[model samples]
Target: MKNIETTLRNVGTVSLVGAGPGDPELLTIKAVKAIAAATVLLVDDLVSPAIVALAPPGARVIHVGKRGGCKSTPQAFIEKLMVMAAREGETVVRLKGGDPFIFGRGGEEVEHLRAQGITVQVINGITAGLAGITSLGAPLTHREHAHGVLFITGHVRPGDSDTDWRAIAATARDARLTLVIYMGVRGSAHIQEELLTGLPASTPVAVIQHVSLPDQRHALTSLGQLHSTIERDQLTSPCVIVVGDVVRGVAAARAPEALRRIA
Candidate 1:
């Protein structure tokens, strides 16, 4: 173990780490230490149990995860917990899924901790888009096929119907680009419909559920059949949806490898 001086210099130090999609092996070395040294662990809804098991046996673990249209732990309470833990001179670890700042409200937590004079450190991990696509053997950017990629989230507030569907659809249609959608299950039906206006229904799509985990499943289908396929497959939350011609290539490559692994 390193000297206490190295770890204790920052009295109310809080490290916010991205836990990746669902694979424990994907955790960074710094993130692992933060977990092992944490006096308290604050986790979001999307974090998996495999990662949480890394914390010291006696460390306190709290869940402050928020989901759409559900009763969520108040953000104020979560911030207060971090501040209180730090004031007690405890090294705190706030674990979030994917990149903390990306759609994870990690910025809000950091802001709150800083306001309370707590030092914060961030450790990045493979986000869902990269992990999801890689698991299916898909490349978001290809020199020959795609020159760029766009990441978007489908989760939005009610009454906020304003969106740039045309812009996104146009890119998908005209350019060598791939579109990755996070938390997209709820609005997938509508997104597919809107995309049809700008892109072809024949475009390939892949939806990955519980990515990188043992139970992870990926379905490859066309945009026209995507909604129905998901319904039939019974995929749930914590899934990533990718749409583009590149999806077909990924499916073609991964299907045989996945089958051989199973065999």
Candidate 2:
């Protein structure tokens, strides 16, 4: 671990560390050092508790977590917590699951902190796209098969928002590009319906649940049956949805029995 000397000013600094996808080894060295040196730690629901245990002793670990279908701490409150801690001249580390910048709302926290004259550091981690793809032995970009790749979130509303999954799906489908969708587990059916407006029904899709963790499971199905397969398999959160020809390769190599863990 690198020596992290958090020089505290009148307004202290916040280090945003990405915890990666349920695997501590995937954490960057900077993230490890930030945790070891933090005086205050704020964590999200997606972050594993084991990762939190790695923080230095006597560090204040606050669970300002937000998750689907659960009571979550408001974004404003989380920012206020960081601001208050920093104002006290404490070195705060805001830890998030996966890459802080990738759909983790780390940007919002940074903007809020900067507005208050607090310095922030962002350490990127292994996002679910890379981890899920690697777990399935599928590459997002392949010279012969796919020239480009697209990463989108299933939770984003279509059109005019900060991010648009529908538009990206249309463009990527038209170009036959690989697509990776994060947090698309519950919305798998809706995503399938929307994506079919752009891509063929036969387009291959893979739903990987609990990727890179023990008891990981995946279903390789067509764009048309993707949602049904997910429901039949009883796949849950912490899953990654992939749509493209690359899924066909995964289907061929991955045994059918391997996907039959649950329902």
The best candidate in terms of TM-score:
1
Question: RMSD of model 2, in Å?
Answer: 5.3
Give all candidates' CA lDDT scores: 0.82, 0.82
Question: What's the distance in Å from true for residue 205, model 2?
Answer: 1.2
Clashing pairs in model 1? none
For model 2, residues 1-263, the per-residue Cα lDDT tens digits are 12233334356788889999877787888889999999999999888877899999999999987876568898899999999999888899999988999988988988999998898889988998878877877788877767788778777543645445567778886676999888888787778887888878888778888766677777777888888998898988878888888766665566665333221
lDDT value, residue 163 of candidate 1: 62
Per-residue lDDT of 3 in model 1: 58
Candidate RMSDs in Å, in order, are 5.3, 5.3
For model 1, the run of ten residues with the poorest summed lDDT: 254-263
Task: Give the TM-score of each candidate.
Answer: 0.88, 0.88
| Cα lDDT tens digits for candidate 1, 216-263 | 988887777778878899877778888886776675676666333222
